[model samples]
Every structure is written in structure tokens, then in C-alpha cells.
Target: MSVLLNLREAHPALHTHPTPVLPPWPRVVVLPANRSPYGLDLPLDGTATVAVRPYVTAHEQRERRRELALATLGLDTPGPYWIHGLEVA
Candidate 1:
């Protein structure tokens, strides 16, 4: 069985919601564990999972443009996006 299958069978409550519009500023995302290539030693402990699809906001787009402009001028100081873990669930 696939990870998605295991997730659904073991956790029927796991449902996907429509992706919502993100804020103009950068937000954080907590990535779930890998659930691919079935038959791994992974286990789902009765927890539900959610997937999110994020799009670039106008402000973010402008920021990216600014960053690119700075990079062209050799003054780029871009920050990294962090992916947190879901331990509480």
C-alpha cells in the first residue's frame, strides 16, 4: 500500500482542505514526513494530515523583484525559508 493509502486507512479523518490565500508576508510551513515508495518502516500514529498550496502574493513578488535587482548589483542578501516539523501531532 502507498503512504497515502496507509494514511487514509489508518487515519480516515485526514482530509484535504482548499488552499487558502496567504498573507503578503512570508509564512512558515511544517513539512510532513516522507510517505513514498511504500513498505517503509514508517507508521502513522492516528494523526490527521493537511496539505497546503501557497502562491506568491503581490508584496512577495515585489520583494523577489527587489532581490533580483540587488543580485544584479551584487548586493543580494536573501533569507532562507525554514521548514518546521510537526511533533505535537
Candidate 2:
């Protein structure tokens, strides 16, 4: 039960502009359970299959979390998280 930012919509300019491509691994950002962006209180209580490959680095993880927190306007809090590349299976 987690929320994920729709990256494509979040940064349309970056997504559509000509920039060096980044790997999908770094694009995944999962919000903690019971948390959702401001205004859109979407319920997340359904089961969904997912596969994850853990990828972590203390510095990088912290930075990523911080960035997400700012982007979400504090709706997302920076906290402990093991970065992972996830795929819906």
C-alpha cells in the first residue's frame, strides 16, 4: 500500500525535452503507505504484484528522498528507505 509519483506527468518538460536518458532504475520513487499527495487522497489498499531489486546508497537514497519530499510540497516526508528498482509483475 504505497503511492508512486507519476514521473511522466510530474516533469513533462524533462520527459519531452532532449536530455540524456537516465536508466529506469533511478526513476522509481515509492511513497510510504498511507501517504498521498496533497488534495488527491487516493486510497491505496489493494493488492498488486511487484518485483524489486534492491539498490541502495546512503547518500544517494537520502538525496532522492529529500528531492521527492520537496517536489510533493512536504506531503512526502524524507525517511529511511532502501532504494529499489521495481516492476509490476
Candidate 3:
């Protein structure tokens, strides 16, 4: 069986969340384990899994700022505007 199948059988709680909609090939940033402020306790083999929480929070902040800027310019920001440029996936 595949890893997903194993995970599904071993941990049901992991499947509680809805499937996240992501691009076919998403960008990946690999941070060196020594440089990472997290995952220090884990036995990392030179790389660390970066947290998405910071990136998500930053994206939200950027969106709010864009809205404010648009509002100041007497224009309304669209409800679901596609984010362009580096989105730090």
C-alpha cells in the first residue's frame, strides 16, 4: 500500500480536514536545518520542514494592505483577486 493508505489506516484524525486546493506543481523552499529556528529537536538530515503559518499570516496581511491601498485610491478591491508575484508557498 501507498503512504497515504498507511496514513489513512493509522491516523484518521489526519484526514479530518478538507483537501487543500493547490497548484499541480507548487513551489518548495528548502531551508537548511541549521538555519531553521524550528525542528531543532527532531533528527533532521540537513533540511527542515518550514511552517506555512507565517507565510499564510503574511499573505493575509498583504491582502489587507492591498485592500486599504485600493480603498485610499477610491477603488474597491475585488472579493477574490488572484495573487500575483512571489506568494512564498
Best by TM-score: 3
Candidate with the larger lDDT of 1 and 3: 3
Q: How much lDDT does each candidate structure score?
A: 0.63, 0.58, 0.70
Model 1, 1-89: lDDT tens per residue?
59878888887656867679976976688899877777767775545765443554667667767766776797747465222332211
Q: How does residue 62 of candidate 3 score in lDDT?
A: 88
Regions of candidate 1 where Cα sits further than 4 Å from its true position: 1-56, 81-89
State the weakest 10-residue window (summed lDDT) of model 3.
80-89
lDDT of 1 at 41: 73
**Candidate 3, TM-score vs. the true structure?**
0.30
Candidate 2 lDDT, 43-76, residue by residue in tens: 5544664544455466777787776666568454
Preferred candidate (TM-score higher): 2 or 3: 3
- Tens-digit lDDT track for model 3 on 8-84? 99998876978789768866988765654674665866455665678899999888788767767978754655344
Which sections of candidate 2 miss by over 4 Å? 1-56, 74-89
lDDT of 2 at 81: 41
Candidates 1 and 3, the one with greater TM-score? 3
